[model samples]
Target: MSNGKTKTDIPFRLDRLPWSRWHVLVVVALGITWILDGLEVTIVGVISDVLQKPLRWHCRHLRQVSWVLLLNRGSRGSYRFLLPHRQVREEEALHDHLGTYIVGTVLSAFSFNFASIAVFRIITGLGIGGEYSAINSAIDELIPARVRGWVDLAINGSWWVGTMVGSALSLYLLNPAFFPIDLGWRLSFAVGASLGLAVLLIRRYLPESPRWLLVHGREEEAKEVVSEIENKVSHQTGKELEEPNKTLEINPIGSVGFGTVFHSVFGRYPKRAVLGLWLMAGQAFLYNAIFFTYALLLSKFYGVPVDQTGLYIFPFAIGNFVGPLLIGKLFDTFGRKPMIAFTYIFSGVLLAITGYLFMIGVLSAITQTLAWVVIFFFASAGASSAYLTVSEVFPLEIRAMAIALFYAVGTAIGGVAAPSIFGALIGSGSPVNVFYGYLVGAILMAAAGVVEIAFGVKAERKSLEEVAAPLSEVIENPY
Candidate 1:
């Protein structure tokens, strides 16, 4: 019953429309994945108030101070002054463990966050890994080629939207008044989990990328899914979809495997990978060092109100959001090296200025907050763009692995030292000289920027395959 041609021969089918409604749905669903990601990363910030409580333990009896001192004083000159130090006879290592916790027990504040954060960060970071890769691959596959750049920009940019929403919820609904003081952070987590579950549900409707499937030799499945998309688009638009020119298809780019990613990217583009990795690591160090400890820093250094800390962080997050979206486009339009270099250079200078202001005691609360905003703006923008450019410069086959490895190594190094290093520098019980820490961060940031400029590869207008093939040839036939 076909009018002009067989329905099977029709290039654009109802189910596989070029501008299908289904594709739009898929993109939105992918955005939710990232929202969950952002929420997971920042959820603990809202919960720190509750997590800081010290665990309680009951002692069996009040032993005499003389008995305690006589039993267990260590071998030292001070011990000779004391008759003897006594140890509490206790069950197993419980007394030893409890003794450590008891040191902070009498203090007004809590202590669990120091340990809880380590575990929660690992869980949240795992989800983040999946979220970044899944969303990028989904958008690349789903969006049409002509509008791909905009889609890429739009989807990746949506992460900031997710972050802002989490911040708003943390500020308003997740406050202690809405839930029991102990459960306030739980509420924020529940909200984020619910959103994550919703995204998981919606993702069920998304078909695998036809291009990816085709490269894997699932041609029939790819064709069927493509047809389905065309059909959906046609039905939504109430117009027949035009078929893509069949002759336009190119040969399949060579498939990259696990090792191929390292070989292709690091072996061929060693300078770019090294430069990107350093920048990435430095960015993580600075972001975590500042963001994790901002409240304490502001309270002590700037005399900012405790209640206003979230407000200050919100503006910094806004800067983080804006930097990536705008800078990424410039990376696409102009060049990666230039944008990366400019962002880091300015960010470093601003950080130094911020430190100097604090050091000199000339910065008022508002001015200090402004300084944080400016530094974070440039830092976050360059950081995000660096990841984007790194991915684009690798072949599609190895792109995922490259991103995962780079981020994993960079973030791991940063994660381990951020707390201890920043704490030592800022919380050493001396007069708060936060400026010294910022000065160090500025130096590292500027060094990363310079190294990137000297060695970073330009991927301004190249496709992944184009970037990878020549390198492969050089490797196979090096002179």
Candidate 2:
């Protein structure tokens, strides 16, 4: 590896490894970020009313700004800005700053004022958004191609684990019978901060991605890291590993510019870029529209108390968690295009049925919640697959940015609009009004499925390099 160029087989070697305990370690260490995200989102959702009481928390604006910031800068641009600086190692800088920012945000909620909470939440969103790029890039590079689909889906699905925990906590903490009004929401934030603290400690042990190192001209360091991973996996599995069968020559580049990334994605892989945007935007619209305002819908239409809303969320979270766990492997087996389309279309159809029932006034609160469970059961897997699609289909150099770009675009186009529209419809006190909102979500989701069927990349079980050739790949002349 010299002055921005190297010929090596690091990508192939990393891809050919067998599934082992080391993979699990990587997943647990890196993927906990999603769980933290889930906890934060669900906590805010459950406590929306509490934050709006006489205290004037104005958490709605705080949440909206945080989310938009997170979607825009947090996922795509922030990591790139931070990684090149030498004041701290890339791994240490991200992990430490993320922990500090999240802890500080949660702690600020104790202040019970709008301004402080808004400031903290903006910082928190930036931190979490940075994690999205760094973590997704690292996980994709480190995990084996054979099992990457299942692992990515499972990690993304684990967000619902945090959701379930958040729901349970809100049920207990939001209850005035147990805790006073002001204290309950403050304690909920404290619990989320505690979880962030624990994840910080775990992140310390995670190594930088060897694939990233190889591409950046750190061949010796990449080799050393891979060797250590091989040793650990072999020891744990009690078996010898086979040699890698594939190799590719690469012209390693130092730093990729934003211009190159943009040209490569939109200029070279335009269809993929569109597919990713549709998948991500569709899910964001459906999820943000429903999940953010679920409590409001129940309290207003079904007469469910705010304190009891968490109980309904618990099962919904379970259904979401189960979807990816159950159907993730099919992405690898049945292939990406068919399964993604099926899940998206199926969930959309279910949501349409549920919304119709909801509009007709035939479904009670319990039945409505059950309908959500079934609809999201399929939706969760499809949403998880969206992340998988964007991350894997891009070249190694631009994978993180691609994920960030599509995520930001999708969030901006669909995610930002859905919540306000749904909130307004709910506030209008007419189920039929809200039905139109649900119809929009359903149509968008199903349209994304159709887009997948028409254009989705069949990337399941393919090495990342095979799915999208590295920008640095060399082509030798026959002459």
Candidate 3:
């Protein structure tokens, strides 16, 4: 990017200075992706029971049956008549009464836990991975630096919006008293999937990122999109769109696509990329360890009922909802390192205290709930901002792959393994040890923050291209 160019110049053409409807639509699309990203994480708990149950059919058999059903529905002619004939009877349906139930039950864990999540999580993670980077990049490209902070705030805030939606669906839609036990969780999944489809439909009206087009040397296309935007904004506001007087230049090196992330472009800024990855890993690990695994931990160790545990999750989600944007504001305003470091150190301390209180049985139910609310709030705030920091740390070229690699790996190691770690630690004792693990997690979280602060230079003031400079350059001035 040229020295005088504002953040907005990177994504829009000179003829279209003000934003257009296409710009808003793209932001909405990106926002939808973010919602879906968060929803997947939240919905797993709601459906856990359904997935854990045994299915009295082999994996191959199940796949074959599903395939057959799908094929039968697609054919227009004899398929309809044959479909009823091909349907499995209640007696023929796989059930647990036979000795196969025990074997099938054992097999279900591998299928659902290992196979299903392992496969689907990668798909989900890929979609999620694209979402975090794409939304930020699109916003960075489209919105000007002056109000860019607010646009980023709105985009970042969508994560919490997603959390609320997922939690509400889990709490209200999946409540068994209102719906049957077996069907409620399915309904929860259906609600999330429905929202995803709605987003896809809305996104059809959105245009491609002008900045991306510019970077790829498609100047005319970029200019056209920008004109469309300016015209729309002018019509809406009934005012002339004023253009800033500054020449813009795209970085020849930064314009490359996803392949460049792992190659020379990202290879230069290895340490910043690594630090971002570490932060992402730490965030996912600590968060999932707590949020994803909490209900089970409470039920198993504290003897809390599942219904009560689900109810308690509402406050946790609320805390998560509140944490990020406020922290993000401070991040950009005060600088990334200090805010992140403070968040981790304090968050760690809170986790330890929360764990200690739970272990010692020193608090009443309300007090315990309050403590959880605080702990999760801080964690949510810290974790969400961590993504913002990562977004700022890397360059446009490698941003997507870098974020994806860090989160996918982090969630797998820290998040997926959290519950088992808690279970192993608790064994049969007082559940307080779960908090001890959190204390350990806090230390790790703080360590990442401290490392980032000590090693991470201030990138808040720099353009996206400059911050992702080579490791040798970054090392020269780490403050």
Candidate 4:
């Protein structure tokens, strides 16, 4: 309730709690951001066929919806650490969920041309970009550090769950028996938007990070939130909870400016910065290179109908989601460096082999998709881990901004050009040409793996404080 400095063990208290329904609630409520993001993109990918036509089954839209991905980097870092993070997240979610729910990209479906839809697409992109900092920060602070790596990977991996839903929904909606082609694509957006609104409702009951509250000198509020969590956990688990083992004396300060954060991230923690950049950019390129144009490859090279492409996404989405679940535990168990480096290099090597097979004209569409399933089984885990790395390696003071910068920079460096380049490769109808793109992606990923070997932070099972002291603690410890 006061702005005076407060000393509290909020971080220890949060990190020491046993697994309970409270954690599950935290995951479901905040984690939906990734799911909705995946759903929207997959829906676009699934319905690209229908979106090309609007009035009277005639067509007009972007060459592809890949531009949305590029623009998602737009609104990041705009709202970093200004207000309370949870409050900022709720506000962003309100704007994003409401905007989509009201008109959906159904407006895009009704567009007169590409320019019209691009406007709406840009709005959606900015809104989604606005959500990541808040979501990742909240999830990192709330979840127990012992399981942080896996939980983060699982939440990020849930994006594929959205892909599954989109693929299935598109199959049903895009069917001739169910709806007209134009109408079907619009419905996909509407459905995703509705889901967004539903999750927003759930997010309402979620509490602010007690760690955050304590640092802001809202000690009473922090204590109440932590106590309520303990009560729920104890009641639900039928066990008494042990006291937190340590305390943090947080001298609440006004704010850490963007300049101080930038210097700290790039200057004080430059090696960690390199690790984050490579990890993020590598996965960004690999995912964007493959995902943005897989449908075109199916249609142009494999003779699959555009409408049936969702069937291919089925197995692809399955492998992507499953990889994180099965491999995610190893991130915490085996440690972040080895697991991260292994996934990146292994997937990269696998992708290289697969690309060579693809270039030789030996595999069918089904077989190619199967290859992706294998490659991404490892790649998905790696990609999801990339976000976790950035969120955890930085000081909590700059965690939100650091994540925002890495995502934006990484996507720009790797994600932006891969799509257009790959689209042109697919346009050439040359398997060897497309494989060149795959080769580049493979090299990028493998190189990132090498970077991990050299520079990755060993953050597994460490409290956020130990990983990188908060800026307040930095002023106290020059070491």
Candidate 5:
């Protein structure tokens, strides 16, 4: 890697390895990031009602204001830009975020006013927001290309697992009879943050991305990491692993800048940039707008008590988690473009139909939740695929940073405003208004599906280098 020059078989070595304990370890180690995020979000959602109810009379006061608090968190995703240029190794970045979130989550234990809650949530968001880039890129690089889609989707789907657990726990925490209203809700965020300490410690045992290593002028470390992983895989399987399928040779560069990534993502691969944007924006809006604020809807129009909101959310979480767990393989088998498109389109149509039912007063609380279950069954898988599409389709030089960019941009375009728009609509206390919000989300998702059909890359089963060659390999921008 001297002079940022190296020819290596790192990609082939990783892509060729069979699923083994090492792969499982990789999944467990890196995959838990989503689970943690799910847990945090669920806890926040459940406690959100509690956050507002410092006084019984003032309970619904922050109903509309809660949406702005959520918007504050989404805006903190701009913290991701701080690392895109540097991409400090995974565990280190996780260390910074894990600690930052833990501290912020702990601080929320004392929040009373809108300002306090808002500030603490921003700190917490900054922590999680910065880490999304590291874990997604690591997953794609470490997992075998053969099963990358399934693994990625399944991991992404685990987000609901956290939500499920949070929702279930909320049933107890939100019960005024079970615990003091103020104390119970405050505990949710704190306890959720506490659980992350163990995961943060576990992540320390994980290795860096060999693909990342090769590109960053650390060829020897990359080889050592790969060799160690291969040995473990052999021992776990009691069989020799396959040899490299093909090697990626390049004049490895140290890093990429905004100009390089801009050219590569937009100039070199314009369609992919558009596809990534659409996929990311649609999912961000759908999740942030409708899904994040569901508890409020149940409490608002459905006349469901706040304590009971989680019970309804329970089935919804299961539907979302199961969607990608089941539908993930299709991304690998049916191909990335079609499966991504189908799921997005199908979910959008389902949501529109369900929104119509809700607006017409034909749906009960139970039916409305069930409708969410059916819709996110497809939507969950599609949303998970959005992250997958962005992570793998870019060159290795900018892979991790590229993911961060998409997430931040998506959060800006889709994440930041979706809540305020929907919040205003929900605050209107009209099902018709909320339905219009749902309609907007559905339109965005359906349009993204259409874009996928036109521009999505054929990345299924392809090595990272093959899907999009390392920037170093490109003659035009050889670093």
Candidate 6:
């Protein structure tokens, strides 16, 4: 265990720990970022009308610029290479960074002018992008193997919680009868920022990933972190933890480059790469196309007032949130491929039917919103599963990067295109036009579901190491 390399059982030890209060603390601390994101996105959507007069175009440009910058450089292959090293340099720094961004978002809302708003959006986007990589890696490493699926889906689904909060807030804040337009929007941002501050306090107590420590050759530190976790679990449960009898021999590797990540993901696991792209891109297209334009559809087609859009959004968010909470456990019980495919295909089918009804002028605003609730119930679970899939299928060494890469690529292909296309269709004042966009999204989702059926990995209840061996693992001989 010297000369820049070490053999260790740290990964096994971490994976075998029982679910405890400590795990819940980690989930609450880290998973709150998703809620922050949902809140930010919902606020922007709800307030789009308020900004239309003065800052609307500017805000839109800022959003596009921030997304491009973050997706391009933040998730690049080189960026992924540096993630583990960054975590090793300081535990909880990533969490602090996220909190700082939330603070910046609050400040941005108070900006007196337009340029400051753009700057704040970029800062906030960068922080959220960073959180996506770091939090996924940490959660996957810390959670017990048996329950990882349910936990991951639940945490990811929690985004809708923020959506619900934002919608409820907008119902009050966006109302001219209750609050002035300017004050309401600012308060919304303040509320989100406040949540971020609370998350920072909770994250302060989180420890570094012991698997990361052992792989980086910090065996003593790894052992210490694991021992502390075990002690807490034992005290809480009033039972002793069993010794880790399993061991893994890993020959530590030096830094990996973009070429290594490219080769591993595409060269060695080409089928997995394709499956990931399809699943991610499909969900991204469906979600972004609808979510980004939902308010517009309501205001334009249904005659729903802009301020009152939150009334519709509240229920939509509930369905999305409940989908994962209700059915997420089935991914573990029934198997990943079956459940993922079912959600994707089911949602896609439902979306097509809803879109057809919408085009024929048979659906009112209330019915349309209800249709969305039903469609996204399945779609949300499928979307959450997409994140779970990419995070789990890749090797630990490149887990962060893999999540980043898939997210960036998928977002670029589907997320970026969806909004623009949908906006144009909606602008043309034609329901039929929008229906075509829905069909495209629906087809992509269902096709991705088929791809999952063909190629998805059944990763439920399996150790991350067993699912995908570390690039640094040392093979043993039976001779």
* Backbone clash count, each prediction separately: 32, 1, 1, 2, 0, 0
- 1-479, model 2: which lDDT tens digit per residue? 55655667777777877778778878998788788778877877776666656554444533443343233222323443444323233476458556755765575566656666655665666577666766777778888888788888989999999999889988889999999978887887787787788888887678887777777777899889888888888898887888887776677775666788888888878888889999999999999889988887887798888799889999999999999999999998889999999999999999889999999999998899899999999999999999899889888877776776777678778786776677678878898999989998999999999999988998888888888888876434200
- lDDT of all predictions, in order shown? 0.54, 0.79, 0.53, 0.78, 0.81, 0.79
TM-score of structure candidate 1: 0.72
lDDT of 3 by residue, 279-301 (tens): 76677668655665555555555
User: What would the TM-scores of all predictions be?
Assistant: 0.72, 0.92, 0.75, 0.92, 0.95, 0.91
Residues 208-320 of candidate 5 have per-residue lDDT tens digits of 87777777777888899999988988898888887875776778777777888888888888888999999999999898887777877887788888888889989999999
Error of 4 at 303 (Å): 1.5
- In model 2, which residue pairs have backbone atoms overlapping below 3 Å? 74-129
Error of 3 at 454 (Å): 1.6
CA shift at 474, candidate 5, in angstroms? Answer: 1.7
Q: Identify the candidate with maximal TM-score.
A: 5
Give the poorly placed runs of model 6, Cα more than 4 Å off.
Answer: 1-5, 54-93, 111-119, 474-479
Model 1 gets an lDDT of: 0.54
Q: What is the RMSD of candidate 6?
A: 3.5
**lDDT of the structure predicted as candidate 6:** 0.79
Candidate 4 yields a Cα-based lDDT of 0.78
Q: Give the residue spans of candidate 1 off by over 4 A.
A: 1-26, 54-117, 141-154, 173-176, 227-258, 303-307, 326-328, 429-433, 470-479
lDDT of 3 at 302: 59
Clashing residue pairs for model 6: none
* Candidate 4 wrong stretches, greater than 4 Å: 1-5, 53-69, 72-110, 475-479
Displacement of residue 157 (Cα, Å) in model 5 is: 0.7
The clash tally of candidate 3 reads 1
- Per-residue lDDT of 124-174 in model 4, one digit per residue for the tens? 665555567667777889999999999999998999998888888877888
| RMSD score of candidate 1 (Å) | 14.3
Output the better candidate (3/5) by lDDT.
5
2 or 6, greater by TM-score = 2
